[model samples]
Target chain A: MRLSSGDSIFYDLFTAAALNLRDGVRVLSEALAPDADRAALVPRLKDIEHAGDEHTHDIVRRVNSGAKTPFHRDDIYRLAGGIDDVLDDVEAALDLMVLYRIKEMPTGIAAVVDVLDRAADLTAEAMPRLRTANELTKYWIEINRLENEADQTYRRLLAHIFSGEYDALTVHKLKDVIEILESAVDGFERVANIVEQIALKQ
Target chain B: MRLSSGDSIFYDLFTAAALNLRDGVRVLSEALAPDADRAALVPRLKDIEHAGDEHTHDIVRRVNSGAKTPFHRDDIYRLAGGIDDVLDDVEAALDLMVLYRIKEMPTGIAAVVDVLDRAADLTAEAMPRLRTANELTKYWIEINRLENEADQTYRRLLAHIFSGEYDALTVHKLKDVIEILESAVDGFERVANIVEQIALKQ
Candidate 1:
């Protein structure tokens, strides 16, 4: 697939967004460490999230300027928005952790973060391939599988929270964080789904 | 602003999706009623959700077949998916109610449902204007305001639930349902957001 200059720019933006997502999820996983500095890590996650926002804005701006898009204009917008959403949820989870003053990290939180980090890595790797639609199926499939694992982990965490194991306040604090983590995973799946749809259309 | 034949089909799909959303939210609100038959309402909600899914699928299939879409292809896909997502969450909320066997409805539940019903109605009213992009600013703005109201209601409900007002199990059940209702509202905002983006690009 011969790429035009505008297509090259779109690919660059998508790649940048993916790398930002991967870095953001990595920070998120690290922040979940039991001994990690919650205060410091959150600001870094915010920077990554802001970068994601800029990338999404850039893509939308380019699309609006009537640049010749490599894929359907709508796919480019969705792909950019979808990638931004994953980062947004990542930032939200970290912010909630800080707001809730969660001290100890739950084992299940680490598990879900691990899945999200891998999904982020997969997404970053898959973004460039949007041009060629090459070998994208495995990326979307893996993301879907990771999301299912995250779902199961989320349910288990919910059950654990409500099993009289934690105080009401603790449950209240933990529930929002866990749900946002699950939403981040779901956001990744949405990005992968969009990629798959683009591939199928191609 | 004249729409071609193919454009009319896209409008019809969006309208149908919006109507399905309105009906699904209505049923969801009714199911939350204290005297309602939860089991029967579940299947009916399921049917509405299925209808939403089919409409979304139809839009995607049409887009895939190279039909001339009124908006950007990505916007159409996002709009259809966003509308379908609200119904999906509505169904999820009802299913959780049944799964958790929540016999009593909280007062806050009805308030959020009322907001969602209006949001859904607003969405149906806005879909036709995709052709002209007429008066959509008000639509998106109103949806955003409704979402903000829903957010305040959600936080208040959360505070009430965690104030030792309900048992831990009850809190667990209500939390998921309320969150999904909030999510449905957010989903509507997303649809409006996509519409606004499309209008801007025009």
Candidate 2:
């Protein structure tokens, strides 16, 4: 399906929102425990969120004005929505890191961060596939698999944290980070779910 | 606007799914501590996951086969997807608790759980409100406020955790759980995001 200018524009907005979130996570990771400027970083995170909202509005307005939608209205809306979920996951993580003043990433936490990066990559990679429903099937499968990997990682990380290796406070901090990262993965998994359903329809 | 029989059925499927996920969370809260009978409880939890999938399949089937959707095709799909998200969020929390062998709830974690419960309730209550998009707006607002509250509590919890009252492992463990629960609130927050967006379109 050749998406109309409106659909393409909407995707661009979604992609931009996702990239901002990805960048936000990267910023958090780059900062050392004491030097993390969450104040500076969080505003940028909210920018991505607001961008998502604005784009959602654009999509809906155009949708109502009788613009030609490339796919079913439901598909376009869900894709837009899945993008919001992805961004929220990232923003939420940044919020926790800065608010808690989480100084250092625990040993297992870095792994979850890696997982978030990979999932973000998948999300980025999946965008072009949305132009054609046929291409979506393979990307959809891969995203699902990546999400499964995230699940396994989340499980292993939780196990290690609870192994009583770290102190109680360390346990709390690391767990907060892990949970946020895992939710981001869940966001990716959800995108996969919507795509799979869309693929069947296509 | 009168809802079609198909629409009613579709909504019921999601209602059942949300209830299942909500119950799953309660089950997890009880089972999370070290004393949980994993041998029996794990299977039951797995059952909840399976049941959720079954509902997802049912939704997909109905969408694929049906011609006239009760509401807009997009609304039906969004409703279905949102319901799935509720389950996914709950399942992730439960799975992590079990995997980590987290014996008991950390103090901050309870606050996060309360937020999640509130969000879930908002979603459940808002479902019928879709019949009147105006009421849905109220649900949207409340859920957003709750997410904000959860956000505040989360930040406070993290600050306290980092305030250095506990040891390293305690910090680590509580951090993980609190973040998970926070993200769970964010999950409901995400749903609220969707409903609010929908209301905006209306």
Candidate 3:
């Protein structure tokens, strides 16, 4: 789909923001446990969260200021907020991983990371199609599929966590981590909700 | 606070929903472990959730119908959805309770119930005054205060859950319940976020 210069700019900016957030999750996932750079990880995670917030503001400011745009201003704003929420939850997982001094992120944690990564990817893929509302259906279906898959993955991961080598304290800490990751997918689900709602309106 | 006819109707419908859900929770809280009337209880709880979805549609339909409204329609829609999300979580919690044969409500569960009750009150309180932008801040503040209190209560309750309790299975079951209760506030917090965001626009 061809885009106006302004719309293209917003798309580029939002895509970059989404990529930063997804990349941040990648970094944290690789260093699931307390890393040697544990002290530095806090600020790194904060930077990721801050970038998410900044991108949120950037998107909203554009929506508020733009007289004309490709699609519903409100829909765009919601999509941006949904993407921002994913980062917030991912950063939250990182925060808990650090705060609890979790020595290791049990083997079960990867499912969440995988779900989040896929959700982020789905959102990234859906961005260019935002201006072409009809094409959103393809992306929307895939996003919905990923969110459903995330739900299954979350249920399995929780069962794994509970059935494994974690004590109550560890279970408590691990649940917090998994909850955040699961929540990121829920955030993605929220984005899917907004997209689906927008599609309904269209 | 003189009401438009539509606002009046919306208020009454929402009030009935709040009462039904509140009473439903009361029933679940008081019932015994084995004889909790699953057939009756499940559908009644579902009624609350279904009511919430209906209320969501009502708000959106009212907005779409060109009703003269005070606050942002989408914000109201989001706020209503958020409240419903809390009830949805509550219902989900009850499902898990029944599935797990959770016999007793923990002492800490009261805090979340209190929060849900207050959120209902706040939403009810906010509705009439929503036609008057002058009064939004107070309503917004109440939601924020309740949400903040819910957060602290959740932390304290979880800490207590970990520090106290019956056994590993008990802790496991209890922790799951506590998290569900706590995430209900997360739903309320989202409501508050939408409310505050709307307030900022005003």
Candidate 4:
């Protein structure tokens, strides 16, 4: 997809935001590892999230400056905001893990992180094509599917938590972490949905 | 604020959505009552949520038709989606209560519902001003503050739940309901944020 001169900056911003999301989720996956070091990994995750915030601010500044954007200015704003949301939730999940002083990851946390990793990868791959709105249908469809899978996983994990397998406190801690991870996956779906909306308009 | 012809439909849709959100949360509050009849209230809440879905669809249809919108079209879409999200989370919370066959509401559910009710009223009152962007700073600021309150309540509720006050199963069920209610409040905050963003851009 060939980008016009005016649209190139948006493409750059979106791509950077997507790559930042990928990095943030990678850190998240590491944080959910069985032997993960919360103290060490959390600061690194925060850095990635901070980087995502900077990219989001750049996109928002561009939109607010009344520049000629490739798509509707609001879509660009939403896309940036949605990507930032994914990173924010990633950071939140990691922070919760640290705050709760959870020594062990829940059984389903890894699966949720795996889905987020794929969603982030797909989002990065799909973002550059936003200039032309090309092949976005598959991107969004796959994202939607992954989100559904994440939802099921979330429900199953909740059931497991409540199934008398763990004490009330442990269940509480794990639930907090799982819900944040679920929100991150949902955040990715929101970005995909926004991209699909923009593509349809284009 | 007198609405221009091009903006009137949007105002109508936004007002209807805000009202629907109010109604949905009202029902949600009732559902959290100690002697509530889940069977009776769930259907009514679902009706209110369905009505919200209709209003949201109307907004999207209008935007998709390239009709002249009062604000940026993307803002309209996001505002509609954010409003619908509040109602959807309300409905989901109610559904979870029924599905979990929860006999008692959590301690903090009422507090969260009160905040949501106030937030909904503020949002409804603010929708008309969206045309002129009048008096909106207070609206979003108050909503943000309410969201903060909801967050504190959520944390406190979690602490209470995990403080060995309830059995594992009961805590799990209550936590699910509380989280969805929290999300509804957050959804309201998202709407307020979008409104603030639109107001600033204007």
Candidate 5:
């Protein structure tokens, strides 16, 4: 086992990245709220996404620098990349909402956003527990469950969007936002699956 | 060096999958034509997608069965999954077009579809060369270039869709189709990146 005590820093970086994702999702939830200042929140969410990139870069550099890692370096890279992908989606979702100048958000979007918040929370909680691989099973299982719930919410929302309540333009804007949110949820599931693979390989 | 002559079978499977992708893109191009009978083409594209899935499954089963592979098993899995993801997007794009009953595609769509066709060609051509990893750089480079072109075309189409020429419902439907097409291009880039990583590791 080449894992040295120093390798624990990787866990810290991952935790920071996951927590950054949680922050991004928080701002996303805020942006989705009616009467919220979405334009202002866009930059704030951008800052969180930038913070996530730094963590991802740090982890990538550490792995490439030939530092000792707790598990497969490939898994570490994938885990970091997966988390970054989610954050990117979250940021994009909010950016789209602001860009589209959407006057009204459709119904059922809140359910999907709530699912993202819960998924983010679970991911942040799972990051630190990655060090003890076996204990992370519950984390991933829950993420899978959350993702399933999110999928249902997403489909329902899609059906609602196309149900002719909003104008076509509004439906288009809302569809873009919700699709990105659903992708974020799916991204969390990918991250969790990576953790599970790491654990199983361990 | 656990590699044997039998390992060449993986390359064959990959090539078959790549060819399947080409078939998919051909059908997709037909479906995009102004005179296309898109409804009839849907099941045909779905058939291509199903074939791609079988190729992916075969590769996974072989890798999991402990067969000697040319590169990392994980990369093999990712390569297969990446190709599968592109096909999924292609099928979804057409599916959305059919479901939305989109009568007329925007002007710039043909350009974006052209880029996808070219990218698919490059990928199919590159797959057989995976055995000689050193020969694969040009493949990925061209893929990157094509993706850049596809990105620009996609953006222009988006601007056009929102340019107020089309009605709101038409804009929404066109946005959905073009976005998925762009994703298919991005998916090819990812697959190329994975192939590059495999070569570099080798």
Candidate 6:
């Protein structure tokens, strides 16, 4: 079960990707601020997403190139793909907000984003733990709990949007944004589940 | 490399799921018809979705029970999950349409759904081929092409919705429906890709 130096690099790449997600979530929070310049921030988040893709590609390339790894190759592919899914949803949420020129967001959005921010932190902290598969139960459990919180926040946010407060067009645009945010939170839970699966196999 | 009788059940389960998808899409098409009864059709599609979930759970149970599989266990997990994803999106699209009580769908919607219909048919046709891993390249290629077509139809549909033809509220509702349809098409592509990966590994 000994891993080569090459295998050790997997931990570094995963940690890099997780840390990048933390940065992406932080910028997303700023973009949601009342006075934030969304137009400019969109590109910044897009850049983070692009970086995330490279991280994913690097992981996949390692697996595809027939390198030996610590865990099942398919698990690596799924884990990398899961992380990319979260970043894609996060970037899309910001991009859509700008595309629809949506200015007024429901207050409940912050609750969901706060959960995502915490998930990002937890994911990043747990990446290195993949090497040992140690003390990882809490990470997945907390992510699942946060996802439940997000689901409630998302429901309230939708109710707020559909309360006939905003015009029809605004409701349409806001719903699009909120649904993607919910997907992003779900993506975190999906990633955590993959981590748990990989741990169990060990 | 020989499969046991228990292993053969996988093909039957997959074929059953794919055939069920065909039935689901046909009902969806019917529900989209101008003269059709969406209220009645919604329950039918819901039934189809529930059936799909059972198929997925059955496949997972077989794998968890340590039964031999025709392909890698993880690939089995992913393929089942991918198929379930498509059904969920398809059901969601139909459900949202009924929830919004949309009476006037754009002509372009039929084009998008048409692609989905075709993709579902192709997928259903390909499931049995998993046993021999034969003739699947065309299946995946056609699905990828159809997805591209779906993307174009979706963009045009969005443009038409935003073209000031309908009121703001109507645009919101139409966009929601169209987005889910697009996701369903993408889900098909994902399933196709997993099939391709499994085929290549074999």
The sequence of per-residue lDDT tens digits that candidate 1 reaches over residues A1-202 is: 2344746788878898899889999998888999989899987998888888888898899899988887899989888888888888888888888888899867777789789878988998998888788889889889889998888788778767766677878878888898888898899999998999888878
TM-score computed on alpha carbons, candidate 6: 0.67
Model 1 docking category = incorrect
How far off is residue A100 in model 5, in Å? Answer: 3.0
Predictions' DockQ, in order: 0.17, 0.42, 0.14, 0.22, 0.24, 0.26
lDDT tens readout by residue for model 5, A151-170 = 88888888888887877777
User: Of the candidates numbered 5 and 6, which has the greater DockQ value?
Assistant: 6
Model 6 Cα lDDT, one tens digit per residue, B40-159: 988889899999999999999999999989899999999999999888888888889889999968987789879988998999999989989999999999999999899878867876
Per-residue lDDT tens digits of candidate 2, residues A1-202? 2343754665555555556556655655544234556678777667767866776777777777777776677777787777677677677777777766666665556666666677677667666565565566666677777778878878888888778887666666677777877877788788778767766775
**Candidate 2 chain B minimal-lDDT segment of 10 residues:** B1-10
Fnat per model, in the order shown = 0.17, 0.92, 0.08, 0.25, 0.25, 0.33
Question: What is the C-alpha lDDT profile of model 4 across B1-202, one tens digit per residue?
Answer: 3444775778978987898788888888888888989879978987887788889988898888889887888788888989988888989898788766788876666788789889989999999888788999999999999999999999989998899978777977888789888998999999999999999999
Question: In candidate 6, what are the lDDT values of residues A1-202, reduced to their tens digit?
Answer: 2333868888888888888988888888888877789989988998998899899998998989998888899999998888888988888788777766677688778898799899999999999999898889989999999999999998899888888898777777788889998999999999999999999999
lDDT of 2 by residue, B1-202 (tens): 2335845676566566667667666765655444667546777777887897887787778888875544666766666676676666666666666676666655666666666666666677676565467577677778888888887887788788678676666666666767667766776777677666666665
Candidate 1, residue A145: Cα displacement in angstroms equals 4.5
Candidate 3, CAPRI quality class derived from DockQ: incorrect
Ranking by DockQ: 2, 6, 5, 4, 1, 3
User: Which digits, one per residue and each the tens of the lDDT, describe model 3 over residues A1-202?
Assistant: 2334856566666666767777777766665643445556778878878887888887788888864555678778877878887888877777787789887776666666776777777777666555456567777777778877877777666666666456767877887888788787788778877877776676
Model 4 vs truth, CA RMSD: 6.9
True-structure RMSD, every candidate: 7.2, 9.1, 7.2, 6.9, 6.4, 6.3
CA lDDT, every prediction? 0.85, 0.68, 0.69, 0.86, 0.87, 0.87
TM-scores vs. true structure, each candidate: 0.63, 0.55, 0.62, 0.64, 0.67, 0.67
How displaced is residue B33 in candidate 6, in Å? Answer: 6.6
